[model samples]
Target: MTLDLIYSTALLLALSALYEFNIRAWGQRLFAAQVCAGLIFGAICIFGMLHPANLAPGVIFDARSVILGVAGIFGGPVVAVIAGLMAGAYRLWLGGAGALVGAAVVTTSVLFGLGMRVALRRGWAQPRLLDFLMFGAMLHIAALGWFLLLPMQHLQKLLETLAFPYLFVLTPSTALLALLLNDLQEQRHAKQALARSEAMRRAITRASPDLLFVLDEDGRYLEVVSPEEHLLYRPLTETLGKRMDETLPPAEARRFQDFLLQTLKAGTPQKIEYELDTLGGRHVFEGRSQALDIRVDGKRAVVFVARDITERVKAEQDRRVAAVAFESRQAMLVSDAGTVILRVNQAFVDLMGYSREEMIGRKTSTLRSGRHDAAFYEAMWESVRKTGKWEGEIWDQRKGGDLVPLWTTITAVRDAHGAVTHYVATMNDISERKLQEEEIRSIAFYDPLTALPNRRLLLERLQRALTLARRNGQHGALLFVDVDNFKQINDEHGHHAGDLLLQEIGSRLGRVVRESDTVARIGGDEFVLVLEHLNEDPALARTEARQIAAKALLTMARPYDLEGLVYHASGSIGIAMFNQAEVDLDLLMRQADEAMYQAKHAGKNTVHMHGG
Candidate 1:
């Protein structure tokens, strides 16, 4: 009996070796592997049963309890159920008085193994040698009670003889088998964890844009990891196991050596900005080096990471130049895409009469003069959208409520995608230029003394009026007036007083006419008035002209104050009514002059009409 049980124990140990090698390969397909494990456990039970320590005809004791319990804890409930069913079915096939009790023992062992599985999973028990021993002891204690269902003769004999060996030998075998499976489970988990960690490290190294290097304290390259081969000064085949002095220029090699020494001494990360002549081109790099915990080839090691920053360095330089140019003498304003002011230079502050604090964070509309309509501004911005620039004259208000004309150029600053990111405007104050232009125009077209339209301007206006009347079928009048006895007054009161009288007469004549009429001082002591938009009919037109002429005579008849001395002045007026039908401009002027002489002959200070 003892020899037969020894054979059963040896078989189980051999099966455990097979499990360690083949079972883990089946682990990926969990249900399939569990079913397979159940079959294997069932086979092992059958082998144990075939060679059991038989005390009766159909009753047997074997390592089925150990195998099923380990299956429940490791292969889970699936293996436990299949193994228990198979072993119980076979035991019942060999019918005897102990058959039912043997099947019951199988069921009780599976249930107890499942319970231990739950305890292990919830951390209530561990898969250790001692814990498995306790588990086997408890499972077999319950299994021993199931034998009570057997025949009284078999039960008494089995307890007296087999109980001690079953409890001592089989229970320890169960623990030893469980401990073997536990070691297999822990090894599988360790391998999986290591695989995942290695995969993650490889992924990070490949995905990184930086060039990674491992160097010794003597500046010898131990390893290099670069995703892009062109980023390296030389290929990895040539770079590895080489000193920096052998592969790089003296200055650059010295720089790397110094950096490596510093990283080792500091025991922390150190940073440096450097330039490298790579296969691609000369590039600026930002390098960070940290001392490693281990040594390489009998020397302290460091890991260096270099990131290319060529574009970033160039952009910073460009920004510095732009900042310097922004503070130039010309007034400049910068705003965001939303037209909210961001920055204004000192020149802009002086020109706008507003401090920098008041303008920042405010919209550009805050400086609007309201001189331009909405449509005008819309068109201006439209040009900037299409062409990226708008340049012209704009009227903007200053802080003191004065409007200034500025020749402004607005340029849109765009990003790489051609989206407007900011607006840069340069302005020049044109106020002085505007004043000078006005003075030039006044000199060309106006009288100096009376500040009225000169003869040149009068003739230009007269020509325009004739063309207008020709189109509208209306009559216009030209009145020519000459002061009475002006030569005598000039001889007596001097040219100054005579000049004063002419100025006053010009003023009075202007008061008597409508704003649309032209009151021009064509010569000394002579003036011409061009009246437009009179009556359409020739007869009514004549009457309108005579009425206006009589009013002008009365205005000239009023007393004039020359140099604070009251001087009475009078003038004779000649009226010539003409329509567009009159072709010759000189003819109209001659007729007005002839009528003026007629008034002078009839009596001074009187009015006469041509062909009346």
Candidate 2:
């Protein structure tokens, strides 16, 4: 019988692997998977019986109970019934006096195994080695009890020859296989679950945009994970296991080493910003570090995330400088390459007696004063074209049609390509002072040229609006407005007249927006509108921003009586819609600027919306 069951343990181990291979499919149809396993093992059990070493002419012995009992315990009632049928039917077909007893053994062992399985489900008990030993003994006893189905002589012969071996060897082997198979299944599942967890962690890390690192308190790199490899100053192999002092420059190394230690000590995150000379060139990086639940080389571990913020810092500095310039006493106007006034100071508004909006997009001729002859104006522009600057005294007409004398300087701003991208014109009043102190106070937070909020004030107000909108879950709009063909006025009518046109455009923008909104001059013919307290629905809010833009378009399109010349002008408007909680203000401004260029490309006098 032992020879007949040769390598049965090996077969059982192989079945453990089979169960694991189809574990997912089994999860969906556990009963079916179980029934299939039962049928396969049951057939193998039948083969084991067929090949059993004969103990007598009519009686036989094999480990059929091992297959049937295990199938029942692991697979439940359905598996038990199927496996019992195969084992019992094959035994009965063998046609011997002991066949009935053989069938009985298979059936009873299945029932015992099923009882334990149901008990496990009910939480009454857990499987124990002693219980399996008891179960194996009981199955043999059941088979022995049916010995009456054998002839008296056959039963006596079987008992004397095989009873001791069956009890000591077969029963113990059955119990051991059952316990071993159960452990194998559990271990396989544990490994599978662990694999899934690791995959999920890797997926999350891969999805992040920031540069990530794991390091020890001693500033040794443990791991580096990043979507953009160029941001890393050192290659992966070079950084891993290397100290910061070895991988980075002295200053940066010290900064990072201290940062990691501080993070470990605080047990909370710390933020820092530093610059690096990477393969991609110099970049400013903002980093935040948090202590991790780990230690390496007897040191606490920290997780650090770094993001590039070079462009953001540069843009902020530029805004601050522009803000300071707008707060100055000189009436200043900044125009883009398209000749549209992009910003202005409040002095221009007070000097011209026009609200900042009125003269924003009007031709420079609007303030011509008719003092300088056509030849004189041509010479001024020609000189600016060649020298990038022209400074002189001139007469400018105000909103009330009064001519005021002023000293002015116009400078051309060029990009790296040596192409003129902007013009900055500053005016210093030469006439007698009038309300000078009051003027200074009035223009404190306003552009001296347009009486609109200066850069500093506009940013504060915008930040507040954004916060309010976020709290209320509402929307806001930012517009970057450029006057189209504005340089034509400066070239033909004079810089003074171009300033007048800008004033007109600015005034019209103010008229079209809601009272709660803001219209401000950045410089030149460029204006910005902060439309606030808008609808929560994105589509509705977008429509409202567009409606206001259309109104500005129509209003600015009307002929302007710049010194009664009746000049026609238009606007190129770019709009960026945002929610307070989500938008970065710098990115929002860039979106608007990009949209404005889109409008310029689409033909001026139209509006363009930017996608976030």
Candidate 3:
């Protein structure tokens, strides 16, 4: 019985080793692990029963209760139920006087283990050495009660002989199994915690925008982690274990090594600005370094974080250039898309006579002169919107309430999406240019002495009148007037008297004709008049010309006072009428001149009609 008991106890210990090293290594699925544990526990229980410490024929005792009970305590309800049914069914199938008793013992041991598990979970009992020992003791005590089912003759002998051995061997085995399971639970928890911490570290490094590096005291790259790989000096695999002098220019590498040594000696954080020609392009970087407490490859190390500032540096340079250009001599103003003034250069302030503070935040319409109506501004802005530019003359008011004409060009500033973001306007004061242009127009198309249309202007109006006469079926007349004895008056009263007589004659001719007619001084003493929109008939047009000629002849015969000297001058007039645009312009002028000569031959201070 002692040797059989050793064999049974040794089998259960082997099962305990399998549970420790083999079953638990299947990993962390609790239900699947417990089901596998249940199958193993049931198999161990059957093997133990087959080699039981036999007291009598068809009556047995071994470690079946120990296996099922431990499965209940550690594997919870699933393992306990599965293992108990298997062992209990096998025991009942082995028809014997102890079969019922063995089955009852199986149920009682399983129930006690499950009850203790509930105690541990609810904090009614702690899973300590004392609790597990007491649990094993109490479970065996209950299993002893199932021995009453044995035949009364065998039951007393079995209890007296085997009860002590069951308690001695299986109780400590149960406690040892619980201790093993507890240790495995702690190990699993620690491994999961370490895995989660490692995953978090990797996630943070992958998401960082800057390049992270570990460099040894000798300036060799120990490790590199770059989220933007293109910004790196080289690929990570090629860069590791490479010295700074191998990747950078000699001067730059020396500067970097000096800063690294300084950081390590100080044992504190250091900062630097540097440049590197990288895979992408030349880049400017700002680096921050902290000395590490550990070593890499037997040398002290540092954690260096580099942030690329290439675009930022370029933008700063561009901003400085734009600042200088914006303060130029040309008057320039910038406004938002809503026409609210944003910025104005010094030249703009001087030109508009408004202080920068007064103009900023105010609408551009605040400087409007009101000479242009709303429709004019709308058209100007429409051109700017469609073509992105508008240039014309505009009148803007000064601070003193005087209108200043500006030759202004407005250009729309747009963003990358082609949306107008602001408007930049350049202006030049054109007041002096306007005055010069008016003087030029007077000299080009008008007589300087009399301020009347000159011969050049007269011919243009005569051609236009001819065009109107043909279109409207109207006849136009041209009158040629001559000062009678004008050369004799000039020889008697000097040239000043002749000039005054010509000026008075020009005024008198204007009064005798309609406003639409053209009166011009073509030569020294000759004048021509063009009347438009006259009667359609030839005789009626001649009568109209005769009446106007008679009026002008009488007015010119009136005396003129030349510098306090009363001077008398008379005029002879001739008329030529035409109703067709096909009439030759030079031929028509000759006809009027011939008629005037005939008038002079007829009598002085009289009028004559051509072909009369």
Candidate 4:
């Protein structure tokens, strides 16, 4: 072979090697580049054969446009134009009548390339069998027209011999090869689409928070996402390939088994609600199962997705509890860390005689009375700060300027870290009980008629005085007094007038004694005085008793006007000094009573002393 033929043959071999390598390494989807390289090499072979000095120009074929046309249809315009240029330039260098024919082939290749380029620019380069056939016909027409027009007198017999075989054999073979290449390209594209779909499925399942699992018809776990570690707490590896009962608790596993069986039998999706224990807490999951047409690994299976609803369930329970608490009848107040009232229920507002707007944002101390000092509050806080609770009676003021007594229990609400966040106080009003207690005290200690302390209180005070005098080694005295001619005043002015005179006498008696003395009514028209810390001399006691008796007599003697009726009254006084011989309260009372009898027996409205 000539060097030019040898070189052209070598180029063809190199192009074929490149096409095979691209098909093996990069797959058939990128086969357009390989096809372009083959067309260019074929064009170079044709140019070399057309040169008489290269190989006598007899081996050359005028159908080189077919290869370039195929490249144009498949590999697009750029590859076609490049292959045509190489073929036209080699033919010119070879110097023959076929040079014109090669130039004509180049013109057709360029036209096809430009036309394909325009079509591609308009988005028409996509593979279609109709367009392929049209391109093949165009290549045949162009090559045959040029061949028939060529004037080669000596080559007519050779052309006739070659034309029939080329038209019948090479054209059909090239068309079949082009169709096969298109089929291979389509198969490669389909394989790529399937691979992408599988990759997308894997990515979606791996990233999903919801648990994705599959189980067999007999309720054995078949496949799971990331099927090694625990999705929540239970390891999927342990559960895999095991029967449902062996993997989970008996009840839960049985339920899952039943769901799987139902889905497999019915060929429809099934849903089940079950509780799952996780690191977060107990969660409620809605599991949906469906019979899968294809098994993951050759077992009849059901695919399932479990969605968590733990927060929604917990929120529903909390809402119910809050509803009950909000409608509770007891007076309740929720306060902030600083004791500012945040919420006050209807009962609290009604009990405290305040509106909701008036109470909220107000400090609890707004209801505090000056009765409890700072020490009392400090002790309360000491207990609260230590134990997170304080419960006691609090004297609070009402809006109407009346004291409201309440028994309150306060609890400190804390967060997860045990920091005090708020305070919840429940209060019960005890105002009615307090009022009743005051009424009972008044009835027990004060005389009903005179509003003065009765003899019961007087005896108690006299005993306290005796105790004090004994402790200090000091003298104390008790004075007993009786109204002189109290019956005569009743006889002259009726019992109403006598009652009025007695009220006047009680007032005058109170005026006669010092503020430190205890004056009490022992009985009708009889009174007692308790003298605390008196002078030791018995005569001084007598003198003080006589002066008080004189003052009382003068005040009572002047009170004669009563509803336009005139009346008069006087009193007799007796004084008894504290002594070791008569130290007890009863002895003091007896001695002072005997002295008063002595004074009355001696002269009315006079003063007398014991042991005189």
Candidate 5:
């Protein structure tokens, strides 16, 4: 039995060695090779070449427990189940008093090994050498218990004679095999890890854009790895194994040596910026050095990576200059090609009352005032595209939704290639200046005393109304009104009372006309009322014009209370009607003036028709 058991052990050991030889070729592939192994082991068990010890006429001792247990430990549940099924089914086919016991042995061995695998994987038990021994011992101990499944009389005889040596030899041998396999598996993993690490190192060296160099404490070049040879001032073949001072200029060599010393002393990393001449041009480089634990030729070394940053440095300087201008006092905004706002200045926040977070990624139309039509914007952008810039008054709404007027200058910021990458709009709030200009214009063209359009504005309106009336084949009239007895009120109540009377007259005349009509105080006690859009009926237009002139005269003639004094005033009005056929503003004014004298001569506070 001892010699037979030894033969079984030799077969198991031989198979383990042979499988290890081709383990890598199988590539794991999820039990592709493990299933083949399980089948071979199952065939060996069935042929009885491995079940070498006969315990009784129908009972045998074999390493089937070790085979399935090893499968469970290494091949997981899928492998264990298939292998156990194969061996157990074939054993049942053979049929004997010990067949059921043999099947139970296969099931229990796989179960015990699989349970240990799960516990180790779940960290319920640590995977150590002792854990392997304990697991292997469990599989064989379980095999001993399967004897009860056999006939009680035969089991008692085997237990009395062969149980001791069977357990003594099988238990340790199972543990020894498992330990060897686990060691071999660990060694295989270590070799895989080393190969992967070496591959990663080579990949990093090849993929990096920066120039890398390995240097000793004496600044001798040990290794140079550069993706682009044009970046190096000298060829690497001539510089390898030579001191930096021999290959580089005196100043640059001293700079490199100093950097090396600093890295070695600090035993950390350092950074520097330097310029070197290359075949392309004088290039700027940013270099970083890290102290290495490695030694070359009995000397400590450091690794240095130098990256060209000439264009990057120049761009940074340009950006700083632009930033100063971009963040100036004016409200400014910048947008991408699609007109989505990317940035806004501080002044924009203050002017528009919108925060950076609220505006970025939003369209510029968020602040649209709805004053300009779409055609206006289209034209403006077309101009900007053509000229690369445009300056004009634009209207935009504030964050509180107020329509704000702006004097904006937009510039199409182009890239070096002259492509419009972004648009910058610098705006100034022109609302206050516009309000001031409106006030100045009002003073220039309006009567200060009555806040009515003065002679200048009145003439302008007359010209426009006459031109429009002619174009539409309509009639417009001009009423020349002189306040009757206006001098009497000024003399009795002083000039202040006279001014008040004129103001009252202006208000009354304005009320009698349409909002589109104009009432102006040309001077003291004299004013003009321009009536427009009297329709196409010439006679009816003349009748309405006379009635309006009469109504205004009566309003002015009514008594006015001025500074707690009752004062009386009246106006003599002369009406003149014309169309585009008589389109001369000066001739119309003369005709109206001559008729005003006719009204004064006819009778005061009366209306007279001109050119009659």
Candidate 6:
């Protein structure tokens, strides 16, 4: 083969390979269309080679424009430009005048491809028929410009034979085809979006905690979504499509129907409270209805959405009833201004042993025991007004002129603006508890045998005396005394004789000490004396301690005549003085105990100072 023929064959093969590569790179769907177009064009070129005709010399058809436009509209502009370059190179290798025509085809194809890509990216192309027409017009204009650059004689023949038909007939037909394809794709996407939205709505309705139902204007149930269907004692599927009266009791159905009708008539929304007698007993519901303009059988109709608020409604009713009963039956009272009683229940009158005529319009102070002063009332009211409630024990006076104790709670009622409206007081009688408390106090602090101060009481009085002496720059004394040989009387003459001797000693000490002093029996044979208001002289404390110790020892030495028995006792005394040197009660007590040990160690029946 000659060099020219070899170049033409190589060029044809190269174009075919380039087209295949573009197709594969873009995807099989796009590549298939371009390959099909190329096959058809190649067959036409072979047919022209076999049967050549001598006719008017002009460009008969421009397959380049057709292929490029198709690629641009379908696979986009980049593919078209690639195809155009391959076509131009193949025609040039053929070494004919058609090469120039091929160059024009290449230029027009690139412009059409790039322009369409820009328009599409910018959203300038409409999605419908207008987009098709605009795109076709742009391609034809590019083709016309390419044809103008051709030789004059050939261009004139092309306009007459090829340009008119391609612009007016072929371009519009191609646009119509593209439009149909777009419409199909849009329909598919719309169907998918609608399906997703419907599935989401169904999921939400099924999982809701409340009983949700849709009703028509005539009160027929269209749908019901409820998790607690067993509580209603009816399958939700069975209840659907039935009238409200058919599925519900007559009374409940009537109330629901009325609410729906009212909502439809008003063209707005309404709420109605009603009760349902289901298998779970009485369940309350607050039915809320809103008018919905829904399409049924291609005609407009109203639908209502009713939600069950059974738990909330029942709780509200129970609270209201309990509040009213509590205010009416219990010993409830309300104060209007600054503890002034404005209202009192009959239970309060009976509890305080007072008539209603005597209690109303009276200040709370009328019941006060005078044990707590005005500051006590102020503190109680402060807590009530701040926190709205206070509860504890309180003391008051009864109508019969006796003090009564009660466990009382006071609460402040406030208005919407947060201003105090009234004070509510509730109380229960606790007089018996107060009496028991007093008896326990006496037992804890006093000695039952001697009717005098016990250890606990003595410690308290001694601490007080020390504090007074420190404040006044005076002195006090604590004397710890023990009977020296009282155990012998119990061992020799029996325990009865020892008890008689101790009683006699206690009597003698009480007679010797002043009324202000405290004489305490800490044990069977031990006693403590707390003497206050002493002179600053240390000798005075010692002198008083010695005098008490002498009186106790002398009283014990005399024989106790108990049921014809004789008993004698002596006492060793330890004295501790409280002055400016002593800082606390514990240290003073320790000093007194040490002194008593020293007295016992020195000898029997003697007194010892803490320093001595």
Q: Model 3, 14-88: lDDT tens per residue?
A: 776666554456776766777877877888888888899887787888888777777787777888888899899
How would you encode candidate 4's per-residue C-alpha lDDT over 341-457 as one tens digit per residue? 999888887787888899999999988877799998999888888999999998888777687788888889999899999998888898788889988987998887777899888
List the candidate 3 regions with Cα displacement exceeding 4 Å. 1-209, 227-230, 234-237, 265-268, 365-387, 390-395, 458-612
Residues 212-231 of candidate 1 have per-residue lDDT tens digits of: 99998888898899989888
**How accurate locally is residue 450 in candidate 4, as Cα lDDT from 0 to 100?**
77
**Residue 138 displacement in candidate 2 (angstroms):** 4.6
What's the TM-score of every candidate structure? 0.83, 0.46, 0.71, 0.53, 0.59, 0.48
Per-residue lDDT value at 23 in model 5? 65
Worst 10 residues of 1 by lDDT: 16-25
Candidate 3, backbone clash total: 0
Model 2 TM-score is 0.46
lDDT by residue (321-426, candidate 6, tens digit) is 8567656646878788577888787778888888777777888778888878888878887888688888888888888888778889998878879988878888
RMSD of each: 4.1, 27.3, 6.0, 11.5, 9.1, 15.4
TM-score of 1: 0.83
Best-fitting candidate, scored by TM-score: 1
| Model 2 misplaced regions, further than 4 Å | 1-36, 50-55, 75-86, 134-171, 216-218, 263-271, 281-284, 290-301, 307-612
Residues 112-190 of candidate 2: C-alpha lDDT, one tens digit per residue? 7787677666876566777778777877777667765677787777678767766776577667877876786778678
Candidate 4: residue pairs that collide: none
Clashing pairs in 6: none
The true-structure Cα RMSD of candidate 3 reads: 6.0
Q: Which 10-residue span in candidate 3 carries the lowest summed lDDT?
A: 16-25
